[model samples]
Target: MTEAAACGIDGVDTGLADPPLLVADGVTRWYGHRLGCRDVSFRLWPGEVLGIVGESGSGKTTLLDCLSGRLTPSDGTVTYRTAGGETVDIFSRPEAERRLLQRTEWGIVRQNPRDGLRMGVSAGANIGERLMAAGGRHYGRIRALAGEWLERVEIDHDRLDDRPTTFSGGMQQRLQIARNLVTHPRLVFMDEPTGSLDVSVQARLLDLLRGLVARFGLAAVIVTHDLAVARLLAHRLMVMQQGAVVESGLTDQVLDDPQHPYTQLLVSSVLQA
Candidate 1:
């Protein structure tokens, strides 16, 4: 892929000629009288990492939820291209089918590891359950894969029998990542993934995540308030403010030469910090 293709420059042919993995068009959500997000549209190609950045109440999380199918939009549609090469509107599909897509083809990494992890279960069980959901039934193979994933995420294999509740915050987050990626989902949705970690821990986790995403050729949509994280991980960026996308483009271009006033302010604040 060319730099233009990797950075998602508009009108630049990516050469792969493959259709987008996911598409969200005119997506809007309303909290009764208030707006959550409005008219958010984007195409996520395979292996692309798109970041959504904004401060609290900027509607980035709301947009992420709508795009990931955790919450249905009041208006607009979320369409996904299946592994079988069929495009389907997620909301229009049967609930079971939509859920099956989530379980088998899509992964969600919540901001809080606790929200994503089954804390009461053994760490090995957590990883194994996802494999089982995707049709793994052999106990020995499942156990082996779980151990392998733990090691891949830089966690000790011996921790497999332990519960997430007993692990440190960073370990729990790593375990959550292992569980999500064990199924090899084509796309992943992340919301404030490193938000709660200490700076050192967050940096290490980010490096791990970057490598894993590359190794798996995963497409991701990450929502975060931190521009530094966005710069590090995202190929393209969409800057949100006041429930709408104020600006969007290649990550470097938007961050380095912001076109919108709000985006400029955001960039300056990060530089000042």
Candidate 2:
């Protein structure tokens, strides 16, 4: 193989040979003197989904923000391993590099669609914005990509030009998923992606998410207050309480026989179909 070909994924140039996609070592985030994830450490690999479940105020969102580079850890390192196998600490990176990764590679979806989306913009534009940041500005490419993601997320492509205001809470959440997934990110951080939707809508969206996540082979960190969400989408589950991971294991084991009291309570709350 040619030197260039050797460095690429089917000539696509994905840097997966070295460094975890995102890594947190003793990472901690603070909110007005409150500790979040005190000395938290974990590694997220490509194509793996790690579920973070905790009650409110358990620091799930704080950990996601720290890993996504939106919040700098108070006393730890957030490292990003590049496509070329260079590892740079996210908090310590120069502003330019950090901005590039934040805009291009990382995808974050929040509990409230309004918080994550541009309500004034059309759904297509919202999805296209990420592509524009990733250096795709040509109208055709952006629209085509947006349409594809819209369909992928089960949104009707015909509504591409419609503003988010026309959609229901479920549709808005689906649009947000499309917006984030359109970037083809390697790691996605979703904070309660379906929290606002009805149970029926949540089930459909959850199924769509599972398929899309597998099809793209993307790694994810999902935070949810719903135990069922953790059971549905996670390969591994990390149960947290008061800013610390108390129990972690394969999702089935963790759900089937939760050893931790907190985990037991969490699992017990789930209702069978």
Candidate 3:
């Protein structure tokens, strides 16, 4: 049996499964005197997708940043289990080691492709860079792998040399996905990946994302305001309000029957929309 299966963390397991990939405890963050996120705690198991949903300033993004190690929480701890089965506190790890871990074992997809992709580089080069960082030295092999990932994300091999500046919004987002997934990271953090796309485009991108996430059995945490997105992509849901998680549970249960007043309001508003 594989290590994941041996640890009862099979890719098909739920968020409640054992041998969690990442764990956050009493996580709280503040921007100056303003609270960003407060008293957040959760576990992300292998292959589970957790959606953090809230309004623009509800602190979902702040919590996500803290979880992904981009921003440190003022209080609490975030620990990640390495692929080697070692648990390490993200904040306590050496800076270089943490950077390497993110580059190799983790992925982050930003709301803006410009933040994630190197606009000046070719699409192929963008993908190749990650492989190179992981010690891929053969130019031919890197380019070939890049081509495969492009196709995997439904981008044509013909556009391998095109810069992201030349692509459409949807296409740029797809490229960003390819670049992030090329290394086959175990955990991925996404922030409103489809928020800027047209409705139809968003639909297509979400479908693509769903397939890729399942295909790889990725452990993901996605932050978005759209309940529809959380419904489609996440197995579990976390509803944030005013820097606090007001509700969390299985997506279907929470969305169908929200217990928190704030969550009820959010759900009703989405339904009305």
Query: Which candidate number maximizes lDDT?
Result: 1
Clash pairs, candidate 1, are none
- lDDT (Cα, tens digit) per residue for candidate 3, span 1-273: 122344465465533446889999999999999999999888788999999998999998899999988887999999999999999999998888888988999999999999999999999999999999988999999999999999988899999999999999999999999999999999999999998899999999999999999999999999999999999999999999999988888999999999999999988986554
Off by over 4 Å in 3: 1-17, 271-273
Winning candidate number (TM-score):
1
lDDT of each: 0.93, 0.85, 0.92
Give candidate 1 misplaced runs (Cα > 4 Å).
1-16, 271-273
What is candidate 1's CA lDDT for residue 177? 93
Better of 2 and 3 by lDDT: 3
Q: What are the per-residue Cα lDDT tens digits for candidate 1 across 92-129?
A: 98889988998899999999999998988999999999
Error of 2 at 75 (Å): 1.1
For candidate 2, list the clashing residue pairs, or say none.
none
Clash count, predicted structure 2: 0
The true-structure Cα RMSD of candidate 2 reads: 7.4
Residue 147 in model 1: lDDT: 100
lDDT of 1 at 105: 98
lDDT of prediction 1: 0.93
* lDDT tens readout by residue for model 2, 1-273: 122345656667555564567777888777778788887777678888999988999988888888888888888898877666778888887778887886767778899999989999999999988889888869998999899888887788899999999999999998988888887887888999888889899999999999999999988999998888888899988888999888877888988999999988877877777
